[model samples]
Target: MPDLLVKLSWSLLCLAHLVPAAALLQPSLLVPLYDVDPASGAGLLLRHRAALFLAVALVCAYAALAPDGRRAAGLVVSVSVVGFLVLYVGAGAPAGALRTVALTDALLLPPLTVAVWSAWRA
Candidate 1:
């Protein structure tokens, strides 16, 4: 069960990274998901942020496969998740499309945290 949880958690984290990476790589693809105006400035920002997300995703993929740095990777991911949540909430409640994103992040937090914990314990 512990192993399963760890794997599941790792997979979820990978997905978390992949989704944004895709959006960043092709902002047009995520038009419905984010429901934002496809302005040049916004697109540029998304692409810039996507680079960071890609880095995180690559690190997480490596951590999932390699035992040596799993803890560090988990820490990085956990911190980033928390930071995003904080910023999101602190900025005031999201509305419309972003509200959906906030909800998804809220739902993902528990499992992701648990996965990191279980992986560390194992």
Candidate 2:
């Protein structure tokens, strides 16, 4: 039950990081997600990618192994999920309707949210 949800969330988070790492190695792999906009330079995108990987690893590991860590990670996951949803809707499909928000941003919603709710109810 709870253990299953936590493990699934952690595994999905790891998968998210690994996918981007593969893309970071190749120039062609990045072009689709990061277009050459004036505000978005290559260096910034690289830095952002690295930061996301770090976050995913740190949070996922903590949530998976530590009881207290799950509470904190659950909080972050809840807030981030809701925030992405709001940002996507407010921006009026800025990144191609629901493409970005619908894909990667959706991974944390159900299991994380349920785990957090269960924790609170416990």
Candidate 3:
């Protein structure tokens, strides 16, 4: 039962990441990799910010309350690191910008995930 819940929570977190990365970041960041117009990219970023934030919030809540939070959190943190690397290298963005984003994700996600998992197990 706990395992299922943990897996579900992890899945949700993964989903949340994908939603924003695809809808928000790609249009703004990835498009620019291909030399798309900055204006259009900004438009996507603006349009999806709220939805993206909402998704992030939902996943955060799930991660906090689910069992196996430690493992889930670790996986999510790994996902973010992998995501940033993919975006940074695969997209051909500047190293500093990618590193900044990657580091931000690393700092924000792991601790929270662990906290939530601990709460759930306790």
Candidate 4:
């Protein structure tokens, strides 16, 4: 049951990263999902952000498959998400879709932390 929970947590992390990755990779595709202007400089920035998300997703997926590295992987994922949340909130409460994303990240922290703790104990 613990193993299943760990896998589920990691899977969720991968999915969390994947969403932004897909949106950033193709901003136009997210036009309906987010309020981003694909033609603007922000759109270009999102593309760059996509690369980062892809990296995180890869790490998460790898961790889920490789039990040995689950602890470190969970830590990395937790820290990254927490850091992003801090920055997002410090930036003065984002509006619209960004706010939703930030909230999602905030909510992910607890589960990610638990996953890391469990993996460490195991």
Clashes of each: 0, 0, 1, 0
lDDT at position 53, candidate 1: 78
What lDDT tens digits, residue by residue, belong to model 3 across residues 1-122?
Answer: 35555555455555545544553444554443333343675555544653554455455556545544455555544555456657776777666444565555555454445444544456
Which residues of candidate 1, in runs, are more than 4 Å off?
119-122
Arranged by TM-score with the best first, the candidates are 4, 1, 2, 3
lDDT of 2: 0.60
lDDT of 2 by residue, 1-122 (tens): 55777677665655555554554455354545544332457745755664565575577677667767777776665665567677877777575524653567676566666657655665
Q: Model 3 residue 81 lDDT?
A: 49
Residue pairs clashing, model 1: none
Q: Report lDDT (Cα) of residue 53, candidate 3.
A: 48
Mind giving the per-residue lDDT tens digits that candidate 4 earns over 39-93?
Answer: 8787777777777888888888988788888877887787779888888889998
Residues 1-122 of candidate 1: C-alpha lDDT, one tens digit per residue: 46666666777887787777887757785567666555667767767777787877777787767767678888877776777778889989778776776776777787678767765777
Report the C-alpha displacement of residue 33, candidate 1, in angstroms: 3.3
TM-score of each: 0.82, 0.67, 0.40, 0.84
Give RMSD to native, each candidate: 2.1, 3.6, 8.3, 2.1
Q: Worst 10-residue stretch by lDDT in candidate 1?
A: 29-38
Model 4 lDDT, residue 32, Cα: 56
For model 2, give the 10-residue run with minimal summed lDDT: 31-40
> Given candidate 3, what's the lDDT at residue 27?
56
Name the runs in model 4 displaced over 4 angstroms.
30-34
